[model samples]
Target: MSPASSHTHRPPALAGLELLASAVVLVDADGTISYANAAAENLLESSLKALSRQKLAAQFLNPEELDNICAQARLHKFSDLRQDLTLERAGRDPLHVHSIVSVLDEPAGHVLIELREHLQHIKLDREERILDQSQVNKELIRNLAHEIKNPLGGIRGAAQLLEMELPPLHLGQLREYTQVIIKEADRLQTLVDRLLAPHRRPHIVGDVNIHEVCERVRSLILAEFPAGLTILRDYDASIPEFRGDKEQLIQTVLNIAHNAAQALSARIEAGEAQLTFKTRVARQVTLAKVRYGLALDLHIIDNGPGISPQIRDRIFYPLVSGREGGSGLGLTLAQTFVQQHMGVIECESRPGYTDFRILLPLP
Candidate 1:
């Protein structure tokens, strides 16, 4: 049957299923698909016309389990059931998905099936944790900075007074100690200021062209690694300009690109380092628990020894770094800037490739 014919038979109340991020389908007691939403088509890697009237169990390696479940639902044995299933696709590896089957009263003899990728569920949970951690980090940093700032000034002042009160002969010998105290106090003060910088600065919103931001970061990285690294752009020109802080966006991209370049130091020296800036439009994206109709999908990819597994989860936390002498504020600040724009940043890394993705809502 044609896609239009199949869609016409779908109940009007089921139309909203198309807006969901999870794959959803309606099937009869015989396990034949009656309707598949857009997400379902994408998940199954098939079109509505192709999926219509097809057995849902046929798409999986363990077909009997799904068939049994559908039969039980049809017999009114259970109102809903959730199970983990493996879907086998031709020419692709098997996918692990969580399936929820709920009996439909309106559509008698039919059940609604929702499919969610296991990895996607993990990603969503991680994103939620990051958002919660970010809020806590903000509060902790603010209070810590305030606590340190007050004593920092007093320490510097006391060091100056101690230096002035020294005897003429002792002044020369003791001057170095006072200067050390004063200099160390100043350094600590600077550190405190940086900790609070993101909260202090205004957002400075304006029309932001994501491609322009990517180009700026690309140039900066190239300038720093002029000899070996190659920066590539795979941008979607159709992306519309949105309102945001241009400088903050630039810094966010730059911080992530710069970190990638730093990680690629060995590859750069070998004249094989390659970093790519990719941008596209993503629909039905959820950021910080709020769903957006459309969002910017930006990726900074590098061919380098990927992030260390030990610190991978804590890379966004303040004062955490994989590199020696690294302050670890780069990614923390990058995440902060992205969060300011109602977006989220995520990283996936392996032995040879690391990808940092930033998703921001579109106007």
Candidate 2:
């Protein structure tokens, strides 16, 4: 038996296409899309059926250039010829990609277009840096919390002693200052405890239904903002339960949802606030430098004024908040909890939309 013949091969249509992390689309000889992989579906923000119904030119800014490249590949029967292209999808920002068009040697004249998003490289690098920074921030928070925690007790005790030492009638105005010190010390103590909570708490793992977590968060949000906020659930019932800390997941989702609700206070008062909890199954997602075959995609989408661009990049940083009264540890703790489960959390915000996407690996 020959060595090459001894090995087994899998078809691209069945396995190869789906396994790829990059967006891929198979176009027919007539320039109509025949197939789109999962990544392609995500990139275009559309489904396979929808993508297949349209021609390739519908997605490209320079359709003629894309057509010429594909035509040249077909004419010369060449493979591996790559070019930079911009894909313009309606209602979404244009995407820049390095496209590789390969002519398949088939009677159907199928051409495979592999799209490697330029932004993906930037995103991956940013995620790596974020992860690194998250670790640094965590260490810093622990140390700072400890340092502040020790002094907080002493400050509150000293204020309490001073209050007891003063006469109630004669020190009426003076007592108020001591009371303020005590109150502020207690508040700082609470903040320090919260900063240390994630690290101190043990992760208790069990089978977690992501929808359950979403429903719990939704219920909590609706209960708090019952009159004005509208919370919608767009869940995929097919996703199976994965091993995770249920309470932690609930808390993480609630923190993000609560923040969204707070950000939508204006819209809520105007009766225009909307929060959607969407759940889907993603394939071939890379999270925190590790790629997973399948992952749970949870999206917390809100229609509000959107997050300010100035602090958007640092939203996950400890003590960073866009809201005035925000503790800022909500998202930081959420990120930490999600990372403990080997997942990733990301945010994208603009004028009318803000999306927090959490990707958790499925076993």
Candidate 3:
């Protein structure tokens, strides 16, 4: 549907304080847009003149979610409400927006809704907490590894030594058991190293072409799985090189792409998998009260089964995985690396498509 002209609208001052502070819109229980604030107008890409009398549920929200919002508004005059929702503009990666519903009683049936982007705050807060916890987790792992590692080596060595003395048939069985112990010990040591790498390393910042990072990850993912999967590219060539650590940038994209690929496994097997790497330039975006004005947008999108609703909010938390039999640290680590680069990552998912969008400042 086409939007109306942007010229007609009420003054910004009358749009309520909540609208001033947040991206919000007013809609009747039938989902028609009665009013929209400046922020909401921008997000919806339609001015007030165009938005008035438009159905909110059919136009923007998924049917089920729209019904739920309407139910809440109909049920009470005032109620505390919170929901995780997504907004995809112009066929783009879905923007992960957290919504808070507050009702307004007036002649025109309306529901006062506010939306806050989750990427900024969570990226900053979660990263700080994870970094600290990683340090503590590292120390405990190092101390434990050292104590058990020495004995583990001796145990494996003794088993090997005894195996050489035994007959061939019995030797093979004992040798296999010893190998298990060696393998497990090696895995523990590897985990400890990962915990320490981010803390011990110095960030090497330089003029980094965001596209280069996407290309590199694209090549790596294709090399690993060259069949039954498609890697689509949608990039804004105008994006400038940003100051970032090359290695870290690569890791961040890799971590996110790897997770998407895992989630797309079934689709890949069916020859219907798709993974897109896209970049754009977002203007005048405010994050954490500071307006960077211009930000680089990178998106990792896929068509697969969506993330489970259960862990959606905590998806970025350490060791939280949407897929079964997954380590879950990929996104946690990706978030950490992006935070180090002073970037933000937002996510949205449904049954068929899932999007992870990363925003970084331009150099």
TM-score of each: 0.76, 0.90, 0.62
Pitting candidate 2 against candidate 3, the one with the higher lDDT is 2
Question: Which pairs clash in model 3?
Answer: 31-56, 284-293
**Per-structure clash totals for the candidates:** 0, 0, 2
Q: Which candidate wins on lDDT?
A: 1
51-80, model 1: which lDDT tens digit per residue? 875889999988898888888888889989
Q: Any residue pairs clashing in model 1, and if so which? A: none
**CA RMSD per model (angstroms):** 5.4, 5.0, 8.2
Q: Give the top-scoring candidate (TM-score).
A: 2
Off by over 4 Å in 2: 1-14, 46-54, 77-80, 89-91, 168-171
Question: Which runs of model 1 end up more than 4 angstroms from their true locations?
Answer: 1-15, 24-95, 99-114, 166-173
Find the number of clashing residue pairs for candidate 1: 0
Q: Candidate 3: which stretches are off by over 4 Å?
A: 1-170, 288-290
For candidate 3, the per-residue lDDT at 188 reads 59
Query: How displaced is residue 348 in candidate 1, in Å?
Result: 1.1
